[model samples]
Target: MSGAIIMLNAYFSPSDLAHVKICPSAKWSPKGEIVAGINGKGSEPDQFDTPYDIFIDEYNNMFVADSLNHRIQKWPPGSTKGATVGSMARPLVGIPYPTKIFVDSEESVYALDYGHDENNNSIVKWRRGLGNNGTLVINEGIAIGGLCGDMDGNLYISDYDKNEILKWSPGSTKGILMAGGKGRGKALIQFDGPRELYVDGTHNIYVNDEQNYRVQKWRPDHINAATVAGGIKCLNDFAVDMDGNVYTVDSCNSIVQKWSPHSSTPITVVNGDPSGIYAISFDTYGNMFLCEGNENRIRKYSIIYNDC
Candidate 1:
């Protein structure tokens, strides 16, 4: 097959929201359309309130951590409205404040609550289909900045306050310090405000060192982490695709960069004017989705590569 690149532009809303546009490229592959949420801001099911994070499952369903509303919304592909899967105002039981969400292979939903009260700020797990209430999994004293799971169901959390990453086994009471447990610093073994993390199939952990404006990768038995990419204006969130390619959003520069494994430099995937990207994720089909928090919209980008 011959390789060719195509660029297409599509407008979402017919009104002022027309500013919300999808620019698709063959190499970068953003499907020229708005997959979920509306362009303008609102609290309705079709809208979002400063959506902090997003996770797309194997079935193309999008689960959003609607931070301001304090709820988790499940948006099926092509649907205008989403179902409130988890919320702080659930009738009998609910999480007080939910900041991030992760969906495992079994479709289990894991949410990180930032803690509104003394007993808050923990990790909650809700089994597949049991969306009403969640069970507390990890309840540490300090708040958790990021949460991710590996192939073996092991959980990894980034404690911003402690400046470390904790690894918790399936049923363990407490987590073992995997990296950066020692105070905040710019050393190889230390981290300053580690935010989001991603674990690949081989259990390699990749963390966004938010304060340091860099991304670090740690192996299973490594004592220190190697910097993969850095020098971005502001690093907010990141995602790793099946091929081990790393994608991260730089909020300050308003662009997204793609880095190959062990590569120090990155290929600018999403570049140009300020978009205010708060989060980034990939679907099963390798499509990239960005959460434009300031614009209050979710944009989709489909990647297509043809081997000639």
Candidate 2:
């Protein structure tokens, strides 16, 4: 049996994704451009209260998990206004607080409705038609933190309540334990509070151990997860480039840093923001998008330096 590391993600593989300008050695512009949200808090089409996650689709459209607003907003390229594309406030779905989101190739939006009526935590999918009464992918007593899908359509979910990761095959009613079933701890086999995970092509899981302030990579069928990046200050979201370089936002200090596989410490990427950057993502052009939670703005930082 040949055992080799397999690198993969929902979007692209590690080996083939570097040409778009996302590299560990690259530097982003010090200033950020307002791509979404009007620098104010409101329920208007151009405003946001607390945006938690950012998902960039294949078409370069940005999908935001508007946590406080309890909806998902889809903003097309060069658009200042966004459409309310997903929600859990329908008469049938009850009131919910959505926290994380992902957009598939078909542009369907999937959000983790963290709490609905205090007990109905679920993953809801809003199809292309954009309806409030979205289809429930998983529900009933689950405390969801984050979720993502693989090429095979399998869903990987992080359960904060159980401190574990579960994999739900397409059409399956239940999720099988994939990692971190030993309760919450700092050990490699445990998750203090897991959030925002991505499944690579070779089945390795890159998970954000939020409370632990680090990123851990769980290889396929393995019990221990190796820390990819550590010593972060309140890391809320992260993105890995095709070269396996990890980019993270220090949510508390408003700093951004990059972790290369060859370095023990991280290189500061950005600093001096509004001090509440909650999420991060990279566009096809290698520009950076950050969700400023306190400022209610999606800030875009273009690539200012590239070694390649």
Candidate 3:
């Protein structure tokens, strides 16, 4: 109960993990299972190309930003063949190479354009059955890298170029700075290559300070941020559990690391592998889903707890 547990928005402590575990996972867990996509990469309905991020709703419905395919695919509770929900053909120019996604309670999906096109650096919103297109909301962000939303309907975006995170309220055109605008540095107030943000229940902001090789937590106090985890590299994605433990994606080495509160280094939750894991999410049932960018698929792992 010292550090945060793994996966998604669902929080778990070390004691509650006996119920569900990622089978055949890493050293802590068992192994992994491929829940979505296929053996090889393709553009078919059941395939993904450079799948970047994932958002799993309470109902276990998954929304994926199939980056290279130039579309957002929705996979229902038990379906492998996903339906194209967000695309490039339509009312909006469309999300070209969506890198990240966030799904609000209203089922409205926000897709962040990876800035593949200078004119298309935008975030598109798509609701259920919105026909193949989405409405462009925030456009031309300065190298938007990561995005997430809170219960208050506020959107948090990490601007890589500006080295800061901005908060956007519902229907608001302008964003207020939340953290790290003082240029990139090792200072707690500064952020270098900030990416993969998360908003907890209390509206706390968790940021992966990539260049600095650490994760910082910004509370509502409006004071200096705290370094939750340090001495890691290429934190492509991470999640904070109910216990405040931080789990991060050490992408450069192809592993997932679990960092407890106030820890200097992290324990490797996942072991060595060759695939490129860009993003990851965990479900309430202890299923771990990760976007294997190099493999072009989303794989799930069930943690096995033996006599724990």
Residue 73's C-alpha lDDT in candidate 1?
A: 86
How much is the lDDT of residue 182 in candidate 2? 95
Would you estimate the TM-scores of all the predictions?
A: 0.85, 0.90, 0.86
- Angstrom error at residue 98, model 3: 0.6
Best by lDDT: 2
With candidate 1 superimposed using the best TM-score fit, by how many Å does residue 236's alpha carbon deviate from the native? Answer: 0.7
Give the alpha carbon lDDT tens digit for every residue of 77-186 in model 3: 77968889888885445887888887765566778876455433567777666587777777753677788877666778898778999887765667889998999798
- Residue-wise C-alpha lDDT for candidate 1, range 1-308, written one tens digit per residue: 11111101211111111111222222655343567676567778888887888887757788888877777889998888888887775522466666788876666677887755433267776666765676666665755888887656677789888888887766567778888887999998989888898777677788999888888988889998988878764888987655556678989887888787655677887776437888887665556788887777788876655232
TM-score of 2: 0.90
- Clash counts per candidate, in order, are 7, 2, 16
User: Per-model C-alpha lDDT, please?
Assistant: 0.72, 0.77, 0.74
What C-alpha RMSD separates each model from the true structure? 10.7, 5.6, 6.9
